[model samples]
Target: MQLQLQTLPKVLSVLVMEDRIDAASAIQFKERLRDLTQEGDQRVVLDLARVQFLDSSGLGAIVAVKKLLGPDRVLELSGLTPTVERVFRLTRMDTIFTIHLTHEAALSDVTGA
Candidate 1:
């Protein structure tokens, strides 16, 4: 799993450069995200543009990340492919986290652009 971490003013953008976030890489994802968000910006956006698939394990990992971030921090998701989006929708995670159509849109939302 490759991740491009960027700091944009009040937000930390984590662009996941992979097609799937399944049982295989979920743990790593969680660990890496934990390391990145330890003491930085409270606003985080996960870019899932390249991710076309997500399983229960992956979903759990995402939720775990959000919970781990605590109440003060916000974790948003962006660029979910239809398949991936459906998983979140079916699991009712769409209501739990904010979803954006694009990374730029998420950035705009946080940056007030």
Candidate 2:
């Protein structure tokens, strides 16, 4: 997985460049997230536009990220493709995450724009 970490004024954006988040990359994903968010206080927006596939491990990895962040910070998901969105919805994970149509929207929400 190619991950880009961008720290904005009031949010940290994590752009996922891969098309799939399966068991193979799940551990790496979680580790990378831990590293990327170690020093941030702003909300985290995970960009999933390129992620067309998300398996059980991927979902578990995301949940682990949330736990890693703890209660004070939040992790929102943005730019989900249809297939990815379906997985979240089908698994009832949508309610756990704040889903946005675009990365800009998620940024604006966190920055209070």
> What is the TM-score of candidate 1?
0.94
- Range of the 10 consecutive residues with the lowest summed lDDT in candidate 1: 104-113
lDDT for model 2 comes to 0.90
Off by over 4 Å in 2: 110-113
Poorly placed runs, candidate 1 (over 4 Å): 111-113
RMSD of each: 1.7, 1.5
TM-score, every prediction: 0.94, 0.94
lDDT of every predicted structure (CA atoms): 0.90, 0.90
Q: Write the residue-wise lDDT of candidate 1 on 5-94 in tens digits.
A: 988778889999989899999999899888889987559999999998899999999999999999888899999999999999999999
Q: Which tens-of-lDDT digit does each residue in 1-86 have in candidate 2? A: 69988888788899999998999999999999998899969888999999989999999999999999999998999999998888
